[model samples]
Target: MDELAALTKLERVYRESSLLCFTETWLKQDIPDSVISLTGFTLVRADRSEVESGSSDHNLVNLLPVYTPVVKQQSPQGKEVMIWTEEASEQLRDCFNITDWDVLCSPHGEDVDSLIHCVTDYIHFCVENTVPSRTVWCFPNNKPWVTSELKALLNEKKRAFLSEDKEELRRVQRELKYNIRRCKASYKKKLEQGMEQNNIREVWRGLKHISGHGKSGDVLQVIGDQAWANELNLFFNRFDLARHRAPSSLPSRQAIHPQLSSFTPQLPAQHSALLPTVTVDQSTVDQSTSTPFRLTLDQVRRELKKTKARKATGPDNISSRLLRECADQLCEVVLFMFNLSLSLERVPALWKTSCVVPVPKISHPKELNHYRPIVLTSHLMKAMERIVLSYLRTQLVHL
Candidate 1:
């Protein structure tokens, strides 16, 4: 509405003015009717090509052009002379004001280069030649003093620009801080909640499933669960892309257990005929040994119970957890037998010291071989034990 009102006022002013200047009116020659309806300014077809080529929009004045009157005066003895009227002379003087020209030429910091060059050329032309001063028509709404007023207006403009820049900087900083803090807090909180570690075995299985060669089917068809499907598909796509860029040595699904079959059986009579059986003296072997080695599972379990009781009464320390973990790993390795001999007794202690876990003797339905079972890595066993313990502890604490 404000724009419409302003346009109306401009049209009125332009119609009242005695001088008019236009540009780019040639292309809009047929648009004269629309212009007249909109602005009520008279359009005159002053040139031939403008009408023929419909180029009236350019170099076409809608208003009358202002002109200076040519006057003649007779001097004494029939001598004739011409001089401008007082009004014309005053208009000329106003247009050629040296002070106005100086002001126009003065340095405005914002537009220093091009504006200075233009003003310098203009002032030089006026000073060096007999130049007649005349006022050029501007658009009715165009501010004639825009060039001279630029420096004064720039003070507030610069302040506004700086203020806007500062605000934008503050906005961006706030967004950055929020995103970074949110991401960090989410990562740490998920760690504390044990989300990633709890599902690690499943994650490994999903990774294996994604390697189509291992799973023997497409991920979507193999994993019926929607969440698992999504995760598997995403990981598989990532793996495929990464593999294309740089191939990774992915581990194969071949079982790492040794089979105890494929051997020819020897007959008892042949075995007896081939060699003589010999037995070593146990007394000599025991005498030669320096260490007593009298450790038992009961004694080890007793040590564990004592440590737990002590830690229950006091705050748990890092060393305490380490020892507890060692005890757990010791238990995981040793399989109990009713014979209760030195082999059974030495197993747990040596297992603990050796830092090795025995192969899991699981009899799951998924097992392919009855004699051989999978040997899990020590690291994997330890990590699994830690995760389960921590998860149970967290649940208990919550309860």
Candidate 2:
């Protein structure tokens, strides 16, 4: 008997070995009642650990509450049917001002008669069957029940099926939750990394200095290192320099700056004595008399002055503003590219502390880089100027 007792004790210990270690931590974090509410069946104390274990031992065990599924005798698996009860029918008929007799009549009589038959059949089947199932007949106007013959009709297998379905649904929900958490964590990490990168560059460059390589000989040279110098040299060697246009102004007739004189072409002077003095030929004179009136050049100039004084001042033009904005946009793009390149570490020497100058404060749009906000504004201004000038020219032609 002692030997038999010892063998049984060993077997019992082995069987219990698979059970959860009810450590203090696990005990304290017992499943909440709300979690229990999600299940259809109550969990026993012994099954708690089994239900709680997830895929791993370190992972929390999850238990999905079991429940009996409500077996609905749908017309066809794919087709959806609304089940209506007797009390519900009466309520709906009253609510909608429908005829009571019409509702109770044959399925073919009333518009909603088919709905009533479906409900009646489902309710009758629930009462007559011998299984563990709950039949809920939902009707319009919030009616939910019919006959009270559902005591002996529920079955275990059906309940198990419903429980399994619920478990599967819970599993899917858990997976989705985990995935969402993982994705959120990853996204946050990436965002923080980007912010860190930005901070590094911002601090290293300081506030005023340009972040990347500085410009030299119209070519961007890396701030430091042999590679950058070589690249800069190669780039500048191939880079073509562009000439800027001079601002428009009144032309000077007198001698001025040598550079201006060199660029300007000399105009031909009019020789007053080139034409020979001619006397009106008496033979060529016609005998017919004509009106001999013509206005003097001085009188014509006086008349033009009077017309100019009478003209109205129109709305101000934006040509000057347009040009300034274009310049600003170009500047902005250049600066942005510089800063961006600095972050990329392409030009080490330019981004260094010693060589770079403090960034000058830009008060106007003209200071912006060409590729940034200024470019868009500049293009718009240009288009507007073109349109206004074209319209003005057309109007002038008409005038």
Candidate 3:
């Protein structure tokens, strides 16, 4: 009814005009054309099928191309993510320091897996409770240097437009342009600084940001398509040995050396007597010399401190930044876990598992060969491995 009233007004305003056309009326087949019929024009209707069929000819006369303006669709904003700042780190450290780990993480009969899981869960809980976070609207074409001030200015511009303040809107537009230039200059300077410091990673990251190439482009979206994922899995594991084939048995020493098999002979009595026998008392030997090396608080602390804060977390969801920041509080528990693992001669199952991220080798990847797998393992496990490696190197030097 409102549409009909608008049409009547349009007819009155354009009394001398002959033709008026409307696209995308969204009118249903059941809606009669008489309801929306204009006063002086003949009612004509062209549905989607008619339009498509009429436009199918390639040699049609005066067929001017109609280019509709492309409107970018904004993606839905994601959930609020934690922001790790100095204050948040301090709060997390305090949380770790105040917690009684002995009471909170009482493992069931020295189960290393249970102990690790409990500790990780508690740490994650503390982080969630203590860390500061904010919702960030991530635009597809957003620049790396777009700060909060610029976002505020954009909002102000919108408000000015809504309020019909031309002067205010123009002022905001000028300010936004200036800030955008400043931000670009600042970002360029930072990239130059990174280059001067010989930080290849940061330089590459900045280059990618400038080129508008994001990490999202590298991800293969095979969610809910199990067949494609299975195909990729099979392609990745193409070189693996077939499970049905049993491994060939290794040849015996005698079989490897045919001459030795038939040439076995007993040593002469005189030569056997010449070989002097030397035996030492077992009680005289030092037993302490053969004891296994145990991990110390300092060793664990050193390894934790060495962890790079910017590195991605593993399957456990334990960030390297958390371990590095709270090394002092984490050292004792880690040391205990390390010693327990050594004593039992078994590592935690959680440490063995890793999250594999497939990174594309090309811009447009279509096959398995175009991707390389990057495995993210536990940071604590890496630290423990480093400790063992250092110990082995020290022992090797002494030998």
Q: List lDDT for all candidates, in order.
A: 0.38, 0.34, 0.74
RMSD values, in order shown: 38.7, 33.6, 10.3
**Which sequence of candidate numbers ranks them by lDDT, best first?**
3, 1, 2
- Which runs of model 1 end up more than 4 angstroms from their true locations? 1-271, 285-292, 295-321, 324-399
- How are the candidates ranked when ordered by TM-score, highest leading? 3, 1, 2
Highest TM-score scorer: 3
Over the stretch 1-399, how does candidate 1's per-residue lDDT look in tens digits? 443234335565444555444445343435454543224444544332554323332443445334322221212133222233455434333435433533553454334334434543453353234323444333222221233234334444456544667775555555555655665565456444554568664455444433433421121222136674455445435755676786568643333223322242346786787787566666655654554433355544334433431231111112232234334333322212111223333222211221211221343322222123222222222333343365457444432
Q: Is candidate 2 or candidate 3 better by TM-score?
A: 3
The residue ranges of model 3 lying beyond 4 angstroms of the native Cα positions read 1-80, 105-107, 195-201, 213-224, 227-289, 364-366, 397-399
lDDT computed for candidate 3: 0.74
- Model 2, TM vs. native: 0.14
Off by over 4 Å in 2: 1-265, 269-371, 375-393, 396-399
- Across 1-399, the per-residue lDDT of candidate 2 in tens digits comes to 443234235544322332222222343235453533333443323222454332223322223334322332222123333334455434332432322323333344322324333433433343233112344544222111211222112233345444657775565556555655665566456546756878665444332223223322233222447774455444433423223345568657444565776676565456556756766544334421232222233332222222322122121111222223223222322233233332443432211212111122332222213112111122222222343365457444432
Reference-based TM-score, model 1: 0.16
lDDT tens per residue, model 3, 1-399: 444344345544333334444544355445566655566455455443345324321211111123322223436456777798889888888888888878855644588888888878888899889998888777665778989898899999989976779999999999999999998899889999999999999999988887866656455543437786677767666666466467889997578897775676567798998997876544433433468769999999999999999898899889898899899988988888899888888999998888876777877687778878788999999999999998777655433
Model 1: lowest-lDDT 10 consecutive positions = 309-318
RMSD of candidate 1 to the truth, in angstroms, is: 38.7
